[model samples]
Target: MTPHSIVPRYRCWSKKLKTTLYTYPENWRAFKAQIAAQYSGARLKVASSAPAFTFGQTNRTPAFLNNFPLGKVPAFQGDDGFCLFESNAIAHYLSNEALRGSSPQAQSQVIQWVSFADSEIIPPASAWVFPTLGIMQFNKQATEQAKEEIKKVLSVLNQHLNTRTFLVGERVSLADISVACSMLWLYKQVLEPSFRQPYPNVTRWFQTCVNQPQFKAVLGEVKLCEKMAQFDPKKFADMQPKKDTATKKDTPPKKEKAAKEASKPQEKKEKKKEEKKAAPAVEEMDECEAALASEPKAKDPFAHLPKSPFVLDEFKRKYSNEDTLTVAVPHFWEHFDKEGYSIWYGEYKYPEELTMTFMSCNLIMGMFQRLDKLRKNGFASVILFGGNNDSSISGIWVFRGQDLAFTLSDDWQIDYESYSWRKLDPDTEETKTMVKEYFAWEGEFKHVGKPFNTGKCFK
Candidate 1:
């Protein structure tokens, strides 16, 4: 049976409902809604392949994007045409009152832990586990850092689960389900016996959650990691792009060879130009694409704009090496070009939707990475403030032109529209104070109520 096949218990508390979920097979994000449906009996049908859905192809279609603006799964659509994206939101919608919480405080607590699962557990887990599964390449420092963060998360969960079977209240709720699902790959990939032994409480809680009939029906029997898995060079190599392995055909006849040779110069010239234009497409490739594009020598997007006296590189160095409030702020204002550069303030339009601190930070990081070609012309200090479920992301950007720089290139458009951008006047004390807070990563902001939780810089 499919992971999302409806549970036998059809005595759903709500009216009989029909809905479809789109995702790839065995995707833990989709599993949240599926497993919740197992308990709530919501009849959450899944379409993961072929005619109903295909990962990259179906998701990119205009029809899908119309319903799900981000084109991300696991997207959900009710038979009534209600649409939802973001796995957590979709899962919450499918969960029953019992699974959601017994009371208001319980509901808040449940969502809190759910946010905890996303913000705390998943980032480090993926960093360590993806490499082991050959889904990503590994770096020793990153792996070690992931291990430490995992240990810290497990310790927190261990203490919390020591006296209780579930994350919130007395019984299974979205909190327990979300946390267990978040840890699923960790248990399956790298948290072997010895490594996991220190967090017996977390292990016990995980086992208890997974063994439930609801989880079992959706996830099957999850096998714990027997021996810690390591990245295999062979598997990683195999995932890399391979040339046409079919044997080359024999040499063509003299006439055919001459015809092909005659087309070579233009073909080579066109191919070279194609590579230059395609440089920014790497942003859409994968997470590692950003790393691979570390020094992508693309055509400068700001080439049409006149040179600015405000040197972005020198300011970046000043911010990096010296005190931000003293050196960087002074350097910025001293060289501030009212006509040559423009300041803009941007905030995520969907603050209520941001549940993961790391995920929020990644939005900043991803935008920075994708804007690689814009580096010669722009700088931004994007910040994520407050904690999970109650956070907001805002940034201060300096661009070479008066208008929004993202508008200059289609490749840079992926993340810009998600934010509401406003041009800021650099001369105002308000703008200078905002710049200091964001640049120095200090001081209070009346907007967010306090300091930022994390921040990223696009230099």
Candidate 2:
């Protein structure tokens, strides 16, 4: 059996700090609260500071590094020598029984809502509040955009909560616990009066969760605090320099004078003409098609080629393109573990390829799927294309030796070597850029550009 630690047996070394639990004094404090409650059955060994450790600062002492190399809090080390990052995964492992659910449908619903909470709620919430709180310094326009997007997502969640009392089944589950903790991070500081006024259901649900006995046991009285109304990016930019500020102060006035002397209303006409004359973006699909004339390199993650262990060529040769594209790929049967992860790919059916637009939509959906709590051990997949409708590619990809991907590896590397596989980065800007490229691809093919359509695959 694979090495696994139940919630009761986890938390070998760290001690729980109860005073700051679940209260959004800070992100770490809120997360600590959830982890402590989830594994309340376990005996904690040591205590650490809470709510005071700021990101990119503090929490980097030698004591902290012994647990998580990244110095990220909410990380745990088990008596069995297992350690891991990512809060959702740690919390799930700790609350093993409460998280899995009592029934199959209930389990699926739990995972679904947990995922919905993470992807839909957390992103916009962070984007909207961080800048306002001075944690992140963002421009006014950028801050406003983030707030608006957050409001839209909150509206969606509010509507969903209108009928359901909890996120998943009637009783509270890990879905509610994890999601409520995430929401509580900003509930006091970010969810301003006006936004809460319209989303009464969300407000009520949040309040009820906080009032629960278990919740209150870990987190005491909630505080009503006002956060900064606006953020100035220049504030952070200015934080690093005093002398540099003097130098910059000397330059803007001269630039303003120069700009005033060079500008006129008539120049607006010339600027518009110049904008029209700008060259269009070089078409990437055209490049791919042109490149395909020669032997294509295995750089594209979507390209159908053979790699070791999971042999793409063998699978392709074993089944015709039509069959391979349509058939559901097999699963590991057991859920993903620290040893590895999984990815699922699909090609556009009729065109026998994918357009950039649909290709991006597919990648986005895959990204969201990987965000599921059950799939938390590894990073998300990379989706790319071979060419336009004439040809395209898609695959479930994982880096070798990664928690999720490592488990899926055969050690022999035989099957994977048969496929044209390229290593992909989970954290690079290029990855997102490639996804956007796929989504923005326009061509003779129209249907391949449709919005993403999601599918269900059980392992």
Candidate 3:
């Protein structure tokens, strides 16, 4: 029999299996597993609060650590004594075959998207959203980079979901659950309407999933971000451990109080000195993190350049919200400022080294993420022009300066060297035709010998 038709070894692929979940209240990670249980009709009793499970105290206990070696939350304990750690694992175990995927190929695709959520989505989502929640420090550079990374990921997802409702198999699989939960914080805290306007597909899919009865059972009445959250110094400071202000109230005589005050100034000075000495060791855990919790000072590389009449942000909006060929392309030429800005053609030098189409796309995505800082002053349309093992990477890049903008900062230098770059003359009709083709992603370029596989826009 084929994998899809094959019967399971066990007669009972028990959807309603009894289990207990250990985690803190309102954890997005735990929500997936709980929501999976809701889908599968699994009996999952969550131990989120005191008398059931205390987060720091209970997780550190020997009993808890034995089941979850890492002492991680959302740990599952089955009625049959089977235990599972990691939110994804628990969610998968709790999911019915339909949610996990019925066939082998379907199952693999489910895992692929789950891995995407963990690797591609969660890291950047955490970096950007945690600081806003006062859960972590915020660094402007890191947060900006994280925003770019998330946008690229969303762009990929947006295109994938453009033609469908769900991530895989046209059903609400673990992939959708995992990815949505991973992005919960971003949606709730930072992905405001203005910010998320570009990725309409992602937003639609996310809203559809969350509004489902099963999902709402776990994550009740989801709210989209209206205002983008900023890192609050006071909020972060409040999260810090409060000092032991509760002191002994032993009644001392008036004379004793007078004597203590007389010596209090000297004692306070010594204590302050000790605090000054110890503060750096504790506070300087991560330089980037400290900056994230507080404002960091850095000069913009594009600050010294003369202001161009062409507004990059306005063009980005046009390209994202309106038709590229009809509106954005026409707008670009009308406000063309060749002296202040330059268009460049970049092609990957090592085509033979490229293998999978996904990997090639990732290489483009990675380059785009690294060039996050460039988003403010640049735009690019990087495309992969083949399938499977045979593919090539090429892109059209627009930057604020006449020279290569990568040389302006150390941060932008990472991926530019891997590609061969040649400045395109804006005045030439050849350049104008190329811009229209690349910007719209529709042209018969006899130069590149492969069909267009996939493309990513960097704005």
Candidate 4:
């Protein structure tokens, strides 16, 4: 007799349903497996889908449109017209208690982390991986920008999972499920063991999530793709003209000396000429092709930073009011924490909106950057909030090392109009305990739901 696999009680929900999974063959397999084994034997069915609509897929068939007017694939139609898109959402609907938990809080926590997976994890990972894999054009500027952003996001996740085994309310939740599935292809196709060295916690968490019977069922018999294309610039050199070779005898002594001296000045002149000539071409191209197609050079900005003891005090007084998000935020970032301590940059949001939205986002980004300074005693974060009242605006700014509580004091909050800033309970023993844990980690930490939001940073 064939032994029947016993479904774990937590995942034994969503039973007796003719759940048609409208998805690409490559995408739907894993979801099908989880349902077949745990739920009431969901039949695996593939829908003819086009590419780049989502995940390199184009048009979703009319059948999908009838089921889900949005036309998103990996979509599921329950027997009761419960139509859903987004793989994680579909997986949750089909899993035990929708793969969140039986409890109300558990469910909320699941949703929270799942949102993080979609909003935080996927953005950077996909941005870096897709282009590198040749699934998208390997634009140097775009890829580097994506990699840097992804690294920062990954670091945040890494710090969060430092001690915790699972995200949200322990065990498995939709959060893990979603991120795991989204990352499935990258790990199999490109994120080789060597590449995973710094991200041990993420690797471990990913492996554990995929090891679930449901995950195995959905992602059956997949082969890892070849190493992803290196986003290095040397690879793109072929797109440019080769330098002319010079014979030894043709080189003159005076010419060589003059050439050496003139090379620096002449190159600058040539570069200006090239820029003028290339301006039109640049305007025509939507993507950055040859823009700085070289490895990023590390500069020690912190080296020459002014060590003036009055910088912080002056900054605090200069822009004490954050009520109106202004250019002051960037001004503060450009001025604060001198003495080679930290660096700041900008992060443009997708589907760009108004200035206020970017301002709110920038403030949060600054707060997170400040957290990094506390860890290393290197720098602080200062972001001015901007954008229109309805849109998301932001700045990715940093200041060299400073105390977190001191920099984000009540005065600063009032000035920044950071209505969302919440102080950790200074008197509470639990707060003290967690603070100890966070400081112990040397600043790389996140406190889950209670994580502070500066309304400017990317926490």
Among all candidates shown, the one with the greatest TM-score: 1
| TM-score of structure candidate 1 | 0.62
Q: Which wins on lDDT, candidate 3 or candidate 4?
A: 3
Q: Least accurate stretch of 10 residues (summed lDDT) in model 3? A: 2-11
Predicted structure 3: clash tally:
4
Query: What C-alpha lDDT values do all the predictions have?
Result: 0.76, 0.45, 0.76, 0.46
- The residue-by-residue lDDT of candidate 2 on 1-459, one tens digit each, is 211111123323233332221111234323533544544454433233344443323334565566566444455555565665566666655554545466888888777766766655665565555555433334333345456766776788789899977777565677777777767646766666765778888777777766666566566655544543455455333221122123455669889678667876668888897556332211111111112212222222222323334433233222222222223122221222222323322242334434543344433443333222222122222233334344333444433243234224222132223234445453454443432332223222332343322211111
Q: Model 1 segments beyond 4 Å from truth?
A: 1-11, 243-359, 365-412, 416-459
Worst 10 residues of 1 by lDDT: 283-292
Off by over 4 Å in 3: 1-16, 244-459
Alpha-carbon error at 311 in model 2, in Å? Answer: 52
lDDT of 4: 0.46
Candidate 3 vs. true structure, TM-score: 0.54
CA lDDT for candidate 1: 0.76
**For residues 14-106, what per-residue lDDT tens digits would candidate 1 score against the true structure?**
836689999866778788889888888787889976799866567767889999976667899988999998889988999888888878999
